[model samples]
Target chain A: MAALGREKMKQLEAQYKKILADYIVNQTEKNLYIAQNFTRQLIQKNISPEDVISIHKNAIAEIFPDRMNEAQPAYDFLIEVMVHYGMAHREHQSLLQKQAEYEMEMKIATSIQKALLKTHIPKLSTVDIGMLSVPARKMNGDYVHFFYHRDDYLSVAVTDVVGKGVPAALCMSMVKYGLETLEYAYKEPSYVLEVINRVIEKGVDDSMFVSMFYGCLDTQRNMFSYASAGHEPALHYNAKQDQFVALEAKGLLLGVLPNTKYTYQEVILEDNDIITMMTDGVTEFRGNDHLNSRQIITSVIRDNKYLSAQQLCQLLYREIEKIHGFDLSDDFTVVILKK
Target chain B: MASKSSVEIITEWDIVAARQLGRNEAKALGFGTVDQARITTAISELARNIYLYANIGRIEIERVDTETEKKIVVTATDQGPGIHDIRKVMEEGYSTSGGVGAGLPGVKRLMDSLEVQSVIGEGTTIRAEKWLR
Candidate 1:
């Protein structure tokens, strides 16, 4: 009987050794099964949970030498904790990958938006055209387009969408399409707005709208016909009168109502006369003291009426920037047409 | 009187913006994950058509809520050359640009309702809607 008991003890010791060896060698499901069975045997042999935890820590150290310095509690926690940690690490890696992909997409989108705002200005001999557009953010909601329809008619449009960023930029692109397509068929400012309003009403959502100023210069007749769709009034500098007049044409904002009627106002331009059309960013700029910005714009045009169109535009922009300390809160756009 | 939003489609990047915005609007309207994906895909196809055929266009998304159910509406309009044969364009596997030809028809299949109006020399407007069941 003594020999049989000693033999049983020896077999149990051999079985435990084999289980630990198998767990260290492969760490597979079969190894896990063996370890579980060995744990039960240890419990049956009156081994304390503390002793089991120590054994597990030593085995883990053998498998992962780099983790030997890690803090380990004396309690016998579930071995599945290690598997959970592995899975969490993998999930973190995948999340970082997805974040990188999103950043790349945003970068590409920003570049495309920037390209859309870089429009080409047309050159005309009869009138000097000066324009500037600066976005508060990476994407601009302001839009301007010049169409030289046949050599006799020069059409220029300036538009401002209600919002900013990607959505606003997208709305501006629609305005571009509306202007291009309507200009092909109509030259009258009111007719152009009528068609563009219909297009916007059909496609634009109620949450958004656009304010636009469309003007056509008949070079032969020296007549400028313009219409406003709830946009800021254009400033006209009469060289002979030596005064500023606001060209206020009334119409509803585009996309607000269908079949909206817009009336066009015509102006006869004399030599050295100037017409300045700007978005609200200029007229609505709040200085340090909340000074009236519209008055400042008018004064600037009145003071710089003698300068060339390009010089006057730069001067006005500089003055506005100086007032805001070079930090503008909105997108700024100005189109200056001088005869 | 649903909440509405609009985006312009000029380049390929605008198409991505439209898709993303559409998905967000649908989600805001309590659309399911499958419905959001479907709406986004339809926006992608419509925005791409604007860039391909019209050179420029606009897309509008709105959320409609009634006493019975909720719905999301999307409208796409372009002043480019309009479609000649509306019936053929709506048919599956009919493409004028050598593509898979599943654009308009695929959008129709994904949405609950689809309406298309085209003037040969003027432009085309397409409106699509999905209802949350």
Candidate 2:
């Protein structure tokens, strides 16, 4: 009877040690299964690391009060891992907030740029005008303005700044204001360009400059006088000859010199003559073949000479889009005046 | 040591590209924000001049590190009408075009060193460098 009692006491002691070891190491089959579910619930409830550590301490104290003091290193490792996770979570949350703020700002900027680009082509009996502007990004750097002066002449200007995004858009608004305010100063294209250069030179930054082509069309005499300020050569289509000739003029870009000289050239418009002024974006299209975009432009105008001004502009845009697979590399703007 | 990248300036978009590439190069060379902005602005001015005068050009950015310091060198070249009077073009208020007359001079002020070479009717090339402080 004594031997049997001793064996039973030994068995009970062994079982107690096994339970304490499992609680310390957290490595028994039953303990591991329970812990997996418990940890998932803890994470789902968003329990902080501090609360989790305290809960673990209390559980260990309740089961094996004497062994709780021995699990210090294991507890420290768990705390370290939890702290790292918390930091990463906070960083992710802040990143998300920053992204949302950036998106909102971009949305507002896009709307403002859209509002500035809103322009309508004037209706006239002597000539038909068509214009289109497309931004490569959310904002554009190309600008076009038209003024119907005193029912005798129509003035049109196309300008492209050497930057993009918000700065370029802001500069475009300044160009618009300069054009509007200086329309009454002179009816000559060269004089108008000089005035605009002075205004922009005073207002704009040194790094920014504008390339522009401004032209005035006399309704009664069918005469066109235009000036170029480092802009792309405007194409003049001779209807009688069925040939496209570039109206090349020499001048410096605007906002570069305070008092620069701009020279103007005169052309007599004939029946069914078409004049197209465009930014470099139209001619510099790069695609599968770097298609001679200028050639395509001239040919399109030649083929569609019978169409109305609006239709011709649409056809030209569509042809260019086809060549580029609808992926424009830069901002595109074109103004067409047909008589 | 030298690490180099080149951007083609054919239009306004190319000007932006040149600026971005320059800024990236400056950043890679451990330049601070102000230095990077200065490098980019200088690149913009040079590239814009090329586009305005030459119609097409290339901007090359290089990172150079010597035993003592690191530096970024930017070179803009064009095969268009070369400068007739280099001194006049570099003057702050003298411009052939109706510009603010700040292209070359502003670039000179923003950079540590500037070298301009041109031959009439051949082309123009401008090299500007900024040393990391």
Candidate 3:
């Protein structure tokens, strides 16, 4: 739309006509500068290019009556050019408006997604926790949900949806609500995983699938129970023996089958023992060429074993980011619980 | 059965040929009978898409063995007018309006992982991988 109203446009048009007539007489640099200023004013008024050409023709006809026949055809050709230019200018403005609308929607979506899987890390006197999830794009495919109701136990799950962007984000919301409906600590990790699996299979698309590692920590008993649905192997650091071992279980990725059974496993959490879980986006960060991403991730944890749980997660993420040149190919997530 | 095979798709017979190659590749890669069925169905869907849209393309079947996993990877490539909106087409209930076709999402369902790369005027290449569990 034109920046100026009808009266202002008419006043500017008269001013431009005077400026053009003066520039025609002298052709001085100062006159050229004045003409440039008129062009800017006309643009600010939202005067189309063709409208400028029309005003030029009127100025010429009023200034030189006998010279009209010679310049009329030339002005007509320029009017045709300006007509084409006007269409292109409007198209560009329309495209910019659409871009702004799309970006605004994406920003709103990002905030909604953040609220969908709100992970509140609990502060327990027995176990310290650290976690982080960074989406490569505006929408996140990887999510970490924490459930801590009783002072005696904490239940958590690290899940990754195979599909990316919006679809994956939506799928994760279904998982969060499903997990919430169940009573915590009383239900085994396997049951929680199976319920989420059934929920995803029924609600999501056939093409969509999810991988998850569900774990529950019993602080008073010093026990850790867990299950996996084709997710990445969680690493365990045995403080007493000073060793690292991968915690793995056999099960299909969720949403692939209606009643896929997941295997449940448990380990006693000795003093200062730590359990680290993550999605493929974290373990497969180095990609195909690097065969030992699991080893590298484990070593990072062992080397930085003394740091706080949260600090360990941040350091591991930074280390992976630095090695991968800061451009993560997928949604990255990490969660660690130290007892 | 070859570890890798490429089938040039031009006629309906080519779709059958690719399916045969997919079964053989699946068996050779140590996939069970149920997995073989899944692999062939995925192959059929991808081949049909190439035939319907790509007209003439190539379907490559390969057995990939990595340190951590073994998988059957199928790739369909063509130099044709590519897909305009890949994300829209991949969504559920999105079928090409013209006629009957299995669509790309079906291929994704039958396989373990699917990756599609399409340039509007350049070409399209789709790769589907099914890991042996």
Candidate 4:
């Protein structure tokens, strides 16, 4: 019995040594590679090395789920390495947990932000809306849209929140809510903006404001009513004349002051009239030279008047991408209303 | 309105994915040539926020048809610390970071219609609608 026991112990020892040696010599290097990458990310984020190790462990578990059950040994070894690297394991875990939490929150916020967009534009009978937008990073400041009530009566607006991250997103939500709440009270372009401005001032602080364009389209009347709040001008394309004109209306940005009144300007639409409303993302898009986004937008509209709204938007984006070579520096958005 | 139409993804504040998702949703709506780009832009901005602030979130896209209309509604939900003052958050230039603060408010200003509900420390829900006509 004793001989058998001794032999059994020897076999177990051999197996353990083999696995340990393989891990130390081969697996350890791979783990170190992953660790190094994770460390880079943490350092870039200004997180401590201990926190880096924790994120590394958590990330490893996720990427290699098959080995999650066996992660305890790996984690122990990581803890030892962290100590050698002059990091406190306990503090690192706490920081890692916090960082993980922050990352989770940002993910949740992005999901929420995506939800704010439309999966499909509502099909309308008389008016068609074509829109395109590219956000810079996860959350951007540019916003644009088309609101069609019926027939030729359409409302469109584009806004840029003053920032890029969470605060801007929150402010954007407020603007959305304010518009929904105040829309019924003010249907005219200027009135709607006036009410929105007041609501925003009441809700917002001095640091935040919205630069936007609000418009009401009368398809039956073949006219439009528009208001601007320190936003970019709407471009009007005349297919007959083969020309593009900018409709500029100057007003204070939303949330800047209470009871700020906005003025509306009128534009008549002819057959095959193309109207484009865009955010600053387009105007500010950097090309090899200073690519006037407005000029490119107008040209695209003139070139692709036959395409449908969605196609036109895509074509414009492709062109912009082509002009810049690749990638946009800002949140590029466009709203095209065809008559 | 159905569950199958929705999907969730995770990223580190990736603006490109947000834009792609917006275009994908528009494509799903069969808005191939029409002007759904503006609505997509609005959605992109809102989703970007979820990545920038919450760091983690869930996005839902559904083909919703009411008695009178058929459109797509996307909702981005977040469970971060939550906005302490939603009103303040909506103001442009009122950013905690140095960036221009045009994310959610800008989205609202873009969509056909928008709805927002938030509770501090709980989470936030943003709903935006786009018309197909």
Candidate 5:
């Protein structure tokens, strides 16, 4: 049995030598074929080339049992395969690393853009606000922010950038900057929106627009002045009437056209009156009975007018949760100001 | 100068206990002033999140070494509901659990550095550092 095994080893060595001789004639082609075959075989058999090489090397080591003298060719072949495998593995790992780096950069950029757009609410004497937002997706173009430049007046605005994901986020950032710039450029609500519209129109592509509701609250005077650029209606919950009322201003959305004019409306908000402002994320929600978002919100407010702004927001969220069974289609934000 | 001046506590998955632990630690670390109330608030927020989200968790408190620029490091770990969307979690007002969506964001605001690691169905670890000096 030992004699026959030696003969078999000699024959296998001869076959290996013949294959090496054939490979030596075209080294590049042979190497290319080896790589391709390795990949194909790995995919086909769900096995790793390294594992195959390891098993082969271990078998040779057991049979010949000598590092320097016996099984040297097998050892050399294993080394070559390992080197080739390492290079291929390194390339594959590097490709994955590059993709991860690209994704990381995208997230950082998106976060920076979000930071620019989602400015925290500025404290003002005119109002006590309870605001909450829950994005239904990774990036929502919905924006809610406040600016208090003057001591007696504070400006609150909510805008929905006209898309979703990263592009919408970028547009929202542009609108935020435009609003900040408009604060310096103009003061009246209508004119401020006009300047913002021009700024965004110059900055954004033709496809983009912003639906906005902007208002200035005068606490001492108990008056509220606001303008709308084709945004969703603002809900005015009269503490006296104990009902929710929608306030609409007639105007085109910002960036829809160059030099579009906006209209301003004025109202008196006395003690304990509530003004609820929101994006379409609240009004456009679909419910279990397939009721549109507007009906759902109106019904919720009608049923629960005694709840605080924060409480109302929570109730609305819970109702939506029940309606969609825990799926939200857009970013939801609601700001309730109690006077 | 005292290495063991600060006390540490580990408790079961009770959100109330975690909040108490956070407040106690923040006070022990010398942030008891009313102006710095947010520091304790942030700590409580993080601890509450961990307790509510995980079945088991741990909290460690160490005195801010004045020699090391007076930085306090607070870490919260949990083995439940690994944040599959960390980026979203970090975003302001984004919460899967019923909250103002302010836990992570508020903690980030209070601390100088915030690092989080989470795996789906595995676990989550949050590290927050607040500068005392």
Candidate 6:
């Protein structure tokens, strides 16, 4: 078997000598295509890459009898490097394939995440409402929903799941269905959180948890009733007192405990008063993982008191833009109600 | 960054919304591509984290034990004005004024047992342990 392999190798070397002579002569712009095509056949003959160097030297010597020392060790070294070049080229080709595949996946994920989280902000004449939600990264873990329970009440829920990506999105879809099922119960903030907690606890993985702030605005009564489940506090800007109030509530995080109950609180909105609901992504300036002073959100609202609700949302986002820039570290969300 | 003319990547993605937030930054910086703006954003974020957490909080990792099991525990401590009566918000039956509960109950269930101890003006220590079956 070994002798037969050697004879075949010798025969291939002779064949390569003839092929290399042809390959070099055909290395012109006009004959480049034919040269490459002929070389492909020579390569397909199972000649070892190292053997090509020796074969090339012999071929060069045979083609140019007087050009003796032209095929030296330098030529041998360069041809050996060509072996590496071919391997590297193949590796590069596969990498480009993987990159294209990844980019395609990212585009798909980005769009799906967008469609899942998309919702319309209602425009009301009596009250101007503005909202902004931005992901710190490509995937958003924050969830917001606005439900109009009746002609007089609009309920907004701001939720932030503990994790990110598809899992968090899956949790969000569950919460969405949970909220939708209790459309009639949107009037009460505590009950809304309670139902969401039950749904999350039952439907979501035990390892996951989410913080939520549910607020219902009674437009006719000018009352803002809200509840929270391990979420950030909503700020109340009293246009009268010229100060900000934190509407704080406490309850177990959704998916944390089954049969957990939440606390409800209500505040009457004086004319020109503002209620800002948000997730820790806004954190009223506390930041998602930091303990920033609550002054940041209030100061923006106070300084831009005359701006429309939409502008307020934009300005708050801009301010967060200052903290986070375009690549947010966490999903920053905010909803503003101006009366 | 306003993405006036977006790259032909994702179809029907928010065009106006995708406005060159990068170009916006690039425009602010005078000139550059979105990639350069991203590089700047990354460095700036690192600088921001250094500024924010320079002297703020710490994580204490230790081996802990409960009545039923042995486990490892992590306690994160932050030195700042604790936000609005957070201790009361953690009380079992007490309802938070308007903020979310401190998430103590969920912590309790995830761990085999959980213990919380705090001192007004001093600190709050939350300890929880998981039973390794």
Count of steric clashes across candidates, in order: 1, 8, 0, 83, 0, 20
Which tens-of-lDDT digit does each residue in A160-215 have in candidate 4? 88777777777887777667675454348888788778877888878998888988
For each model, chain A TM-score?
A: 0.72, 0.79, 0.88, 0.72, 0.69, 0.74
List TM-score per model, in order.
0.54, 0.59, 0.66, 0.54, 0.52, 0.56
> After superposing candidate 4, which stretches have Cα over 4 Å from the reference?
A1-93, A117-120, A287-289, B1-133
lDDT of 1 by residue, A3-50 (tens): 124356456555666677777778899898877877787655644333
Two-chain DockQ for each candidate model: 0.01, 0.01, 0.01, 0.01, 0.01, 0.01
User: In model 3, where do residues sit more than 4 Å from their true spots?
Assistant: A1-10, A25-33, A286-288, B1-133
Q: What root-mean-square deviation over C-alphas does model 3 reach?
A: 21.9
Deviation from native of the Cα of residue A39 in model 1, angstroms: 34
Best by TM-score: 3
Q: Which scores higher on TM-score, 3 or 6?
A: 3
- Candidate 3 per-residue lDDT, tens place, A210-312, comes to 9999898888888898999999989899998989888888889999999988879998999889899999888775555655787788789888899999999
Query: Which segments of model 1 are wrong by more than 4 Å?
Result: A1-99, A287-289, B1-133
Candidate 2 regions exceeding 4 Å error are A1-72, A81-85, A287-290, B1-133
Higher-TM-score candidate of 2 and 4: 2
Docking class of 2: incorrect
- Docking quality tier of model 3: incorrect
For residues A170-219, what per-residue lDDT tens digits would candidate 2 score against the true structure? 88888888887874754689998998899889999998899999998998
Which model, 1 or 5, shows the larger TM-score?
1
True contacts kept of each: 0.00, 0.00, 0.00, 0.00, 0.00, 0.00
lDDT of 5 by residue, B1-133 (tens): 3232221223433444554555555566675232134445456666666655564666555446566566556677767778877887775435334432235755665456789888878778888776654
Which CAPRI quality tier does the interface of model 1 achieve? incorrect
In model 6, what is the error at residue A220, expressed in angstroms?
A: 2.6
Instruction: Give the TM-score between model 1's chain B and the true chain B.
Output: 0.92
